[model samples]
Target: MASIVFAPADLVVATSDDIKVRFAGADLAAELPAHVQAPPGAVGVRVMVSGVRGPETMQRDSGFESARLAWYQQRQDGGPAREGSAPTMPGMLVLERVGALLRDDVGTECPSVAGQVGGDGTEWKGSWTYLPHPPEAARTL
Candidate 1:
């Protein structure tokens, strides 16, 4: 799997067409296609969380459901943006917590918090690494 690290400030923004993922210190943006099977050599996307601050309890709420809901909603709208006529594949969005990794195989459909004290405690700050799953053919090699 190939990995892309995202800093705390990096934004993973979702749009009507695609999810814009930014890599730290780089201008590269990975557009995760929606509602389609990945092409012959498409890679899947996974995220690993690190540098989390706060109690260990927060780890339990890995925010998988919320992510899945958002992904489903996005696809229901229209799906990710495409570059050309070439059909793009929808990659999985896996969220890896500190100890346990939650896998959300984002095929067709699939599925956080932290913040100030007394402020819902639903906000969390951390760095995440994006691991791209190798193409099916490559995995067997």
Candidate 2:
């Protein structure tokens, strides 16, 4: 449950392979948590996004679907192309990363970050973080 808050200008971009990030230049890859499992699934990616979104803001109504769309659109347009929309908030997104399986011990307060693809298959839960360009920054995703 550790957390890190990055300045609005620090993150440069993110892609399917890795996130290109830094205080300014593209010199570093933002580190993922140790609990992260490989072969990351789409639903898990969404959880990490929620983590990056942090717990302070309103949970996106469409979950990460809408945010993902907006982010990709920003990248495709070469920069922030939206006109006069609500200002984007700046803060570290609080993504849920599971450390282990909770199984039948799941509790009422249990986070959605756990679970796995069982023999019959199951959906993974959680997301990662990214500093989406604030409206003022208007930079690429």
State which candidate has the highest lDDT: 1
Query: What's the number of clashes in each of the models?
Result: 9, 17
What does candidate 1's lDDT look like per residue over 27-85, in tens digits?
Answer: 11233444434455443343333222334333323454455456666666766622223
lDDT of 1 at 127: 27
Candidate 1: which pairs clash?
Answer: 17-80, 17-81, 68-111, 113-122, 113-123, 114-122, 114-123, 114-124, 115-123
* Model 1 global lDDT (CA atoms, 0 to 1): 0.31
Q: Which stretches of candidate 2 lie over 4 Å from their true place?
A: 1-63, 80-97, 101-141
Candidate 2 per-residue C-alpha lDDT over 30-120 given as tens digits, one digit per residue, 9 for 90 to 100: 3334465434432221122111222322243245446657776876776764543432222222111222221122221212333222111
TM-score against native, each model: 0.18, 0.21
Error of 1 at 50 (Å): 3.7
Candidate 2's displacement at residue 77, Å, is 0.7
Alpha-carbon runs more than 4 Å astray in model 1: 1-43, 54-122, 125-133, 139-141
Q: Residue 57 deviation, candidate 1, in Å?
A: 13
